[model samples]
Target: MSTWKETLFGDPFAVEGDEIDETAQSEAELLAKGNVFEQPAATRGELWGYYLYYNGDNGFTMNSYMPNILQSLAYMGGFYYDGNTTAQNCNNMPEGAVCYVPWAGGSIPVASMLLYIQAIAFSIQFVLFTTFGSLGDYGRWNKWILLSATIIGCASQIIPMVWVNNDGSQWNGMMGMMCIALISYGASLVFYAAAFPLLADNLPVVRKARFDPNVSREDYVLVAEKWRNNVSAISTTFSNVGFLIVTAVLSGASFAPWEKYDFPDGVAHILGNAPIFNYIATVFCGGFWIINAIPYFLWVPAGRGGPQLPPGENHLTIGWKNIISSLREARKLRYLFMYIIAYFIFSDAVNTLNSMIGIIQGQITSFNGTQITILNLVSAVCSIIGCLAFLWIQRWFKIRTKTNLLIIIVLTAIVPIWGSIGIGSTKFGIHNTWELWVFYVWSGIFIAPIWAWQQTMLAELVPKGKENLFFGLFGVVNKASSWIGPVVIGAITQSTSNLWEGWPFVLGLFLIAIVIIFFIDVDKAKEDIRLYLLENSDEASVNGQEKSIHSVHDTDRPVSAKDEKFV
Candidate 1:
């Protein structure tokens, strides 16, 4: 029987407690020397729990709850004369809110404050990701490093719950928590995403593909992609399910009449039900992560880590050197660079759009906890639908990855384009409360699974070797543009005091990026990477054969298994 059958499909003769015999040439072989044969490895479900909880906490606690509370807190307290007020001149800020910051002698809007905070947060995250340089992909570092980052982010969620008050003095606390959450999240996210390849590699099915002579190279390549997409879609779905779980719980609490039972004095303080629920949700998400991560740590084996480090290169310098050298090589790799530039801008626009929506949702809904939670539930549900839906569309039509992305990008742009309509008039777009429902539903379905497709995009463009080096740069570029969108949106919203004004800028960004992405030819990119590898490849780089078996992890963390052939 072909080994591809075993790698592509599970062994019918096998049972639980099985370890791949690494001394031989099976798929589960590891490059590393040590193996604890007695330890029971994770079932696929156990492996999945990592994505479920980590992503849930990161997406909900950091992106959804954190920003919502920060903006609302600033709204409850942020105010001034020259910036915005209910006097209805500069824009639409409520009356009597305590002003937080004096911006050029005028107070900035809560929305602008949140946007600026987002800008700062991403900037800080870029630095952290740059500094770390995918060190999590090497041996022994991935598990500990990923857990540390997760713990830090989860720990910060507690700050908002216990410390924040609407007395206007709590802005510093919120800002501090924001920094911790954002930086930890950036590191943890790239770290988390880096685990996918290890999981796919360790799968009995994927492992067998390596030694199967019956399978043609082209067939194996196609199967490899199909297999990867399946796993990634599952991971993305789990993330959404985590989002769904968090929002559903919040919605249940919001709709319940819990306000009647509260007896504590000075608890709600200056803030109301919405921010309080958000704080609770944040803590809940943290707990959810802790509970889910326990299984991953206990059951997931840390595989043989990344290749041995280069001589004389430390973590910081190594990643920088990799990026710099890659850039030097980029002059010859046209399509890859082209895709990177487009992906960079497109990712930034998407991120800014998310923050912009959150702030704007708070604006129109008056920060009503019930409506917000309900909307969150809608988005979470729709995000799942989007992931499954897009995956189905891709599989059913057999559409190329680029085509799927193009379709998704065009559909996603409709949101900002529609919002731009609000800049001119209040009839349609996101101006009305009803429109908020549409926005969430639309974003959940079209925008949620974009990152999965994006991963596939980079994989297609990268040469056979140098996956880590180039992917680190890809991760950097994906997030590096974050500083641009939020700052631009913040300035616009700050100047106009109308959140709608920023939508135009976001729309232009989305449209322009989509255009660039449309023109990128993946076929041409494949050719470029192929020719580049033939000419420029060196012994320092892992060759193509080893590349197929290379275990990808930020450092072979949660998804890693102790199989030698995998690396």
Candidate 2:
């Protein structure tokens, strides 16, 4: 019958019941270790931690926004309409005026080329992320990856200024553009993989509010119930704002429209391309990296202590060794492996579907550039609302209720995929294009939480000592599976699907993937970090506070004679 406010301050899980002796428990259980994890009465950062976290999140969020912008342009240019031909359906264009005049006479295969561009980019990204994930584990400057990604993103967008033709087929220009994209995606993966391990390093298990050895099991469960609440706050207050900004850009007035160019609206414009948007992104990216770089160099403390390796290990050897070691460690955690499997299946599907949304709009309707952009803006706003709604739902359900929630999310995701089947077919007097937007909003709402929750759950599953290595392997799964989604749908659409039937097949697979979500163990996830913290903190106290915040190893544990000397 206790209110949430009272529950927050008073331990409802008190083991000694109503007469719980906090002092005696402190003495017997080696507790007053609370002081070991003390915060200052107040600090400038504490007052501003929320703001700082927003900045960090915004930095990463801005980093993610680059891909959406590039993809938005690509989808509209390559898939929705032509990037190469005469300007059409607009007030400013001459009747037969051509776009990208340089490539006007050349025969260009646009769709295949774009696919190749994406495939090659993703391949490079996979390799870079694998390497960066390893580096992040062993305590390299992970934040630098974000800087690299931002620079590459800006450079990629800007490269079109020199290379693209007004006609759609700037073969050389496209190749150069693809190369820049490769570098950007590669760097972005590195940034993404590197950022993940920070949670393990910076946030302690007790601070996570999921575990305390001095408390009883019921109280621990009570604390675990708040895990989703914290993440929900993080997602809504930080993550949604980024989604809003990016979506706004995509849905606003078109930066490069097909009407100003020469050919059919869907053709490629290889030359005489407008570069204003690219310049804006480049400037923003430069600012983003410059601002974020200062914090990495100044404020953030290095927890792993300047990256020590056992004698013969440096970047090359250590990097390869780290990958192999991470893979080996991953094999040991069955729970993590299962989650990785489920995540890959679900996330890859989500990515591919999101990537092609603009194209879907273009194929079904004669919507103009501004409308396309605005629709995307609407989608972004809707997505933020969807993400926030999901988090609110999660908060409503106690942490232990995750098992049921996962069942519902996974099950609900299937409906959009199923609904997408008739999306372009037009069943109820509505054009397929309008229905496609509805389906897009529907799927986005259901699936937005899956990404953040999966990461949070993975963080829980990771053991204390192996957080970096485990998450590194998690990155491997993420990148490796990324290509599969795009390749599958792209291939299906290219080979078998007519203008009518292709999207439904892709939707079916999305529906099929939902069944696997039921197999995952949310109960284990809820208790995992709590269990890890309780175990580690107790051992640290028992050993007379010998534990460094970074490293907590037991000195008294018996080791084989041969291995003992290494420690």
Candidate 3:
């Protein structure tokens, strides 16, 4: 009869006291042998694969829809020109609480309105993210939160069906509906806060390790360098994909005769229209989001040390105590704080640029809908390539964070110049539209890695066992900052752009962010991981001792006694 150990790890089994050996063993094996770090060494490719798919929809798919959604909403309110359709003018309603006509026949000052909305949305998301971020940490299942958000999102799209009229003006029904729709955005935060930490928890420690094991701890300092870069890329990609699709649709390409359908008045029309693709897309897209989330439940190990807070002592506590405790605990991790702050700054700029680009390209540029749509399609293809390439680069180069940051910085400096020129130019000497498309594609290569790096780094910044809390904070900052980027661009475009000057503010912000990126510390994070691993080695040695002692005892004891006991 084979021994249990023989059956598990295969053939000859020897437990080494080394830290690496301790991490290499599975949790079940560890339990059998009383080994700590019981969580198995997660395979490198497996961990990476899980996270890659998990996050694919997160920034790119969801956030990409932001500009388009807002645009649709504005369109329904009777805004015109800035890609406004006669179908969207909402100023002709009869007197009533619901019919305070907003933008009847002309553009509703989109840049200004968007700025205000984004600013408000930003603050709201921040509060929502902060409030619910710890749900996962406190041991709550996120599935319900996701489901609730999905339902709310679907319903929000339907509200427009009643308020929007054929003449492109809002009926009295819109005022009430807009309030509820904005409120619904909060539901998304609950889902994000829970999901981020869940992803972090899924990553194996080895996959999280960055620096060389030989490095010094004193030299290690946590910074947002690489993670920041990745977030920017991810956000940009999301913007790229959605904007590309919407722009393409508007680009004059005729929809398949059967592919088209009439949308009902109000919000439902915007949500379900040809360009917007209806609330069904929202439900399905959101459903897909939930589907991706399932693997985390199925495969990822639960957070160790149980919940971050004990029962009754959780966020439910009255008197602001929960809020204070959450803040205080979150503040303890200096690295995490730095990363979040960095995320706030750059994300604001990127998001704003995305919003501005959609509005400007759609309305301001003489480029027709077909041209805009074509450019966006090109952007999508480029983004996909860039995303895949970045992953390959990470694996092939075995590059350190500092090195990666340096590369990103170089690309950041160079690509924006090209992108800015493409956006700013009146003529490319050759239909200029194709030139913009080429630029969009080329720039995506540099932008695709931002989220991947940021997310992976954030996972590292989190305490080994408390990934939930760290990622909760991540979601808080990430969503909160989301509104800033778009608002800034909107405000600037509103104030600056005249017939003569173009929207240079977008390029200016990108440049400023690049300057900020230079100051971030990537090397320090790598060194920290190396030092932490070394310090924890001693605790790992007991596995070797237990195995050695047990083997010796077995050899010294009589074989006949062991056999008799077995019998």
Number of the top lDDT candidate: 1
What is the TM-score of candidate 3?
A: 0.56
Instruction: Give residue 472's lDDT in candidate 3 (0 to 100).
Output: 46
Residues 100-213 of candidate 3 have per-residue lDDT tens digits of 124344232544554556566557656654555445334445545544654565455454544323333432243334334444545543444334322322223311321223
Off by over 4 Å in 3: 1-108, 139-141, 158-165, 171-254, 258-312, 316-340, 364-380, 409-436, 459-467, 497-567
Ranking by TM-score: 1, 2, 3
Location of the lowest summed lDDT over 10 successive residues in candidate 1: 558-567
User: Each candidate: what lDDT?
Assistant: 0.64, 0.44, 0.42
Q: What is the C-alpha RMSD of each candidate to the true structure, in Å?
A: 6.9, 11.2, 14.3
TM-score of each: 0.79, 0.61, 0.56
TM-score of 2: 0.61
Decide which is better by lDDT, 1 or 3.
Answer: 1
Q: How badly does each model clash, as a count of residue pairs?
A: 18, 38, 40
lDDT of 1 at 10: 40
Using TM-score as the measure, the top candidate is 1
Candidate 2 lDDT tens digits, 70-157: 3334333442213564333222333222112112353222333333455556666677655444454344555565556655654554
